[model samples]
Target: MTSYYDQRGVGLIEVMVAILLLSIAVLGFSALQMRAINATDESLVRTKSLTLVRNLSEIMRAYPNAYVTGSATSFTTASPTATGAVSTVQAVMSSSATSTVTVDAKTIDITTSANGCLSTGTKQETVDSIVKTVPAQHCNMSQLAARDTLMAKKIAKDEDISMTVVTCPGTTTQAIQTQMCVIAAWNDTKAILSDSDANACATSNGVYKTDSHCLISEAY
Candidate 1:
């Protein structure tokens, strides 16, 4: 009888060990599945961010003058009065030496007065035709750029995305050229695993806060 009881106790110990091992395997699989889900979510967010950046780049290319020469303006779609739904589109036009002016229907010649002062002399000729002032087409490039930027944000369906257009000076062999840059930034839904991961996803500002992604593109 004593030998039989000892054998029964040994059998119970073996069964307990098997159950422990099985529990460990189940837990390992659950952890792996959670990681896979997180990875998929991160990938989707990255795709959306890239698409937003590319769309804004195309807008800048469409209206080069407004993006490069107009005053810097910022528009936000969150505002009640906002016409577009972009999170924010900031653009500025650069200054240039060109001007549009209107003159009478007369021929003017550049002449110097007695005191060497520059003066305009109108030539007295036969008047045959009446000159009508043609209004210049106000290049509302700034407005258009802002509108398109907002439209892109709306299309992406992400309100956290923001775009900025700025003129950056570039040096050439002949003269300085103005370059436009379209920068887009958005908050990433993925959680950062480590300091290295955050660094790898840093933006142009060198900020690795583990919360956002950024992209930039330039055009002449």
Candidate 2:
């Protein structure tokens, strides 16, 4: 049998090895915790983006007719009074993450007011008929544009969004303008879509409408 002192020294070496192994295990656990936190943050950002899209879509659908026939007189872009128009959808995304959101508007503008009359014809002379096209961009184009800018700001706390109103041929009779879909997308290089391609998803009202197709990748 070796001396007791020799056995004591072996026990100390064993203890040292155990301590080193325990430290490595603790570091592994800490790393996993950090990864979990990062994943949670990314998930939250994605959820906010989806929610922002749905919320804006709901607003559009809620007032579908307004988008088409929004009168300059009735429209107020300076300070919107619509419920959930200001704070709810945008504040969450802007405040919660480093993400950026943008919205773009497309319009079909018709030029040259035309003329038409009721089938009866007995009621009156040729009446000027102007049917504003869908995706309207009216005299209030500036206001509408400004509103979109504000909306972008409210949504992303940044004015990185864009809106474009394009002119198109109207119905057989009168000139009309229309405001189409509003697209919300993150400005990240990794983001799948952009505003220019938003209209590709919509039905063609006429040759007059702008190209609005979204080139969504298969990876999405």
Candidate 3:
């Protein structure tokens, strides 16, 4: 004869097994949710990086001379002493030359023949003198491309981003037709995304990288 106590004992064992299975299912669902959140964060970062790279490209287009004329030079100040005076300084700097001057407690990098002024330590208002009154008849596209590449690196540095600009054929020879590739890379520890091209940017431990290419024609 089946005893009532035996029946109750069997029921308890079945309930325990069901509860254990539910716990495992809940843990799996939680892990999946966490992964989704990580993926979303990675996507946002990648989108921002792409926007920055594109912004740089547009800036290059606007200041073709600054990028194309390898003639631009830069210099650092000998010693910058802070002055209580607060005023804007304007100077005409020549291309391929660098001048460092102290202005209003800030050290300013004045690049002659280029657009804009860079300040170190503290921000200062500066008005740059336009060096070129007339445009050049011919520009060395290769040199300009190289200059643009350097500018991209500087702009992306604040975000811990890495950038590379490469002209096709990898030569300094001036050409009327060439393609320029801009690559941006950043560390993505989660390894949620893949790079656009294996050689476009360096990758380690789940780094995400992308590249943008544009064709330039310098017709005489």
lDDT of each: 0.43, 0.34, 0.39
In candidate 2, stretches whose alpha carbon ends up further than 4 angstroms from where it belongs are 59-149, 158-220
Ranking by TM-score: 1, 3, 2
In candidate 1 the C-alpha lDDT for residue 54 amounts to: 72
User: In angstroms, how far off is 183's CA in candidate 2?
Assistant: 7.1
| Per-prediction TM-score to the true structure, in the order listed | 0.51, 0.39, 0.47
- Model 1 CA deviation exceeding 4 Å by range: 68-89, 92-139, 155-159, 162-220
Over 1-220, each residue of candidate 1 has an lDDT whose tens digit, in order, gives 9888768778778889999999999999999999999888767766776777677666656754432222223222233133322212332212111111111111111121221112244333333675443222211334444445545645554455544544332423211223545545556422121245543334334334544565546544
Using TM-score as the measure, which candidate wins? Answer: 1
Residue pairs with backbone atoms closer than 3 Å in model 3 (clashes): 67-144, 68-144, 71-96, 72-96, 73-96, 75-98, 93-112, 94-112
Instruction: Between candidates 1 and 2, name the one with more favorable TM-score.
Output: 1
Residue-level lDDT of model 3, residues 92-125, one tens digit each, is 1112222433222223332443322421233233
Cα RMSDs, all models: 16.6, 16.2, 13.3
State the weakest 10-residue window (summed lDDT) of model 1: 95-104
Lowest summed-lDDT stretch of 10 residues in model 3?
85-94
